[model samples]
Target: MNKEDLLKKYFRQSLSEEEEKEFTLLLESDHDFKALYEEYSNLNLAFKSHEAEELKAFLTSIDEQEGVKKIIWYKSSTFYYLVAAVLIIALCLPFLLKPSASSLYNEFYEVYPNVEQPVVRGSEETNTYNAFKAYEASNYSLATKAFEELLQTNSNPNYKFYFAMSLLNDGKFDQALNTLKDLEDLKFSYTDETLWYMSLILIKQEQPLKATSKLELLDKLGSSFKSKERKVLLQKLQDN
Candidate 1:
């Protein structure tokens, strides 16, 4: 592959081991390529930030392409649209092929057969997840409505965490704190998430000692929570 392709692989987190090494070496030796990569990174970040239905439809089309080999073209009125979608998907394929929510849920929760099965199909879980996808894209307005609707019916911990985040991002500080406290009470697993968000809330409330206390609880749960984050929280608390 050319340096352009290798640089894209680096950005997409899809670089093969050899490609990564070469990309690093090139980064050490090249300036123009790095500048090009910075531009691509900015454009990709902007694409991710936009919350239009067209972008969502384009992503859905790419998701539909996962197992296909040859993509077909339609020579109809929508040909330009189809071509645009195809190129966007081709460009984003590497970055977009992340493991699914189920995979991430399993990895993080590691719930046992002996334990309660996740309410994956429940109306609450599904609605909360829909809100979370919006919240993940920083669309706080829609996320606020979705999460509030879920909160009215669901007391699920993971849902509450994301809901709290949706509220917090919108500067609804008191509501976020209340949600975090409720989630802390209901938490069965992912206590680190509970603690982490609680830390943020306490910090917002100007309660540094309480925030550090939350970080301490997070550390007790272990390092699925970033060690760096724990250290930084500690340092911040100390500085405060």
Candidate 2:
């Protein structure tokens, strides 16, 4: 099925296991699909909120009017037009709220998952294993220390990338930026991801111009990594 059908199935919670996997792959790799999903998700929230507000208003109006008198009023054609107006407002609500850069960053930024060395149950207790375990468990301090030690003997770009992520998660923004900058210079396997994270860090640091520069470069590179999001974020930054 197409992404729209997959998303509809997802919202209905009717996707089969295989379809669920396909949906996840599209969400991960297809930036346009991810953007569309986010838009729909936000619209869903707006609709739910609008429904709750309308229900509460209806109850309030009922309580204010004579017993069951206003109930008949709601059956009028005017009431249907009011409902249409409310639905239109609900559809427009998400677009009406202009989010700030930091809010956008928070909305878009997710911690990079440990795809390099996934920790398995009953694995051997090596330092690398421990590092990944700590990282996976959100123990950034231990993960940072372990990855730092691992870096002493190994120069893997993957190690450096996750080490930066650990430091970033531990609130070491400057260190993370430096590490990502180094990785960016290296143009390693995670170059696209490095630029993406760097842009996020810059956004967090309130450096919109620098962040835009990174995103613009990423755009020019034509990398698939968050391509649609990069464009959206860049536009938001420029508009701000």
Alpha-carbon TM-score of each model against the true structure: 0.43, 0.58
Tens digits of per-residue lDDT, candidate 2, 1-240, equal 988999999999999999999999999999999999999999998999999999999998878776566767788888899999999989877756666666977988989998899789998999899999999999999999999999999999989999999999998989999999889977777889899999999988888899989998887888899877887888888777
Lowest summed lDDT across 10 adjacent residues in model 1 is found at 108-117
Model 2 CA deviation exceeding 4 Å by range: 1-98
Model 1 over residues 63-169: C-alpha lDDT tens digits? 77853423333445477788889999999785467443233223333111212223345446567567765675678778889878887897676666667667777
After superposition on all CA atoms, what RMSD does each candidate show versus the true structure? 32.6, 34.4
Residue 10 alpha-carbon offset, candidate 2, angstroms = 91
Which has the greatest TM-score?
A: 2
Evaluate residue 103 in candidate 2 and report its C-alpha lDDT on the 0 to 100 scale. Answer: 91
Cα error of candidate 1 at position 65, Å: 85
Worst 10 residues of 2 by lDDT: 93-102
